[model samples]
Target: MTPTVQSLDHLVLTVADLNVTLAFYTEVLGMRAERFTPADGSQRWALRFGSQKINLHQAGAEFLPKAARPTTGSADLCFLSDTPLADWQAHLDALKISPEEGPVRRSGAEGPILSLYLRDPDGTLIELSNRL
Candidate 1:
């Protein structure tokens, strides 16, 4: 028998500026930014949505057990929303954010999804999607 994998809880994002990272996630993507004190007695920031979260680490001050080579602007992540794609487009339009490419169909982890591609302040590719 093999161990069964359930789901993801969190991942980490190495950022250059904590304030900018927190703001982008919380304001642009509609995520919530939170601070927590871990066992090490240090405060850390995280961006959370639904049941998932992404811990933020300063590029030069990361926690132990980090990636072998952590770098900013290296991650390409996709996020899902219950809101329709058209609504997402409007939201982006209101924000004055341009899409690199999008309103295109792609295969999601579960099924089909329509997505919009954009870049964050750190140049990380961020995908906003709707499950179809």
Candidate 2:
């Protein structure tokens, strides 16, 4: 019998600049930032959003045994937001970050959603969506 897979816990992101990425995630996107030193003695950072998190490894400073093809601008992640898409658009406007595409209707894990797409500091595609 196959074991059922639950929700995602975390994922790793390889970034070009840690500080810029952290600022975007914490200040603009409003996620919580955390720093830690792993067993390999390398310091790493993560941004926590709701129950999930994204661990950040600097481009050339990754801990051993990481993704074989970790690259900047490779992630395209969608995050569910409690705020309405209109409000999120205003928030992005206030932050001076332009949306790449959307308030477009799209399919989500649970149901139909309206999403706003933008790029992070390292050009990772980020989608902020609200359930319809």
Candidate 3:
């Protein structure tokens, strides 16, 4: 038998404010929303980020007793770009993204990783890193 392999299709995140999240993804992150639709005709919305995506379901579903609220800091998500760290920093500057910190070197990563830490509209921490 052989192990079947597949690429990561997407990542789903539940957000409290769909509009804010969508704006951040589009404006700050410079990602296009490939799809947007309301599920069940409510506040729930689906947003796509490149190949990954996040579903912002309304707060009151049976499974979700509460809406997906923002966290104190940071999401467990990391996005890598082919652009060099210096170039990424310039991009951020051009967009006025205002990173909390970094374009600093990450030691434990496999190679020379330049990273910038920032928060999304939901206060979800995001790390943008590139291997040099």
lDDT of each: 0.92, 0.90, 0.66
Clash pairs (backbone) in predicted model 1:
none
Candidate 1: where is the Cα deviation over 4 Å?
none
The RMSD of every model to the true structure, in order and in angstroms, is 0.9, 1.2, 4.3
lDDT of 1 by residue, 1-132 (tens): 999989998999999999999888887899999999999998999998998989999999999989999999999999999988788788888999889998899999999999999999999999989989
- For residue 88, model 1's alpha carbon misses the true position, in angstroms, by 1.4
CA displacement after TM-score superposition, residue 91 of candidate 2 (Å): 1.2
Query: What would the per-residue lDDT of candidate 2 be over residues 11-80, giving only the tens digit for each residue?
Result: 9999999999999999988999999777878777999988888999889877778899889999999999
lDDT winner, 2 or 3: 2
Q: lDDT for model 3, on a 0 to 1 scale? A: 0.66
How does model 1 score by TM-score? 0.96
**TM-scores for the candidates:** 0.96, 0.94, 0.67
Best by lDDT: 1
List of clashing residue pairs for candidate 2: none
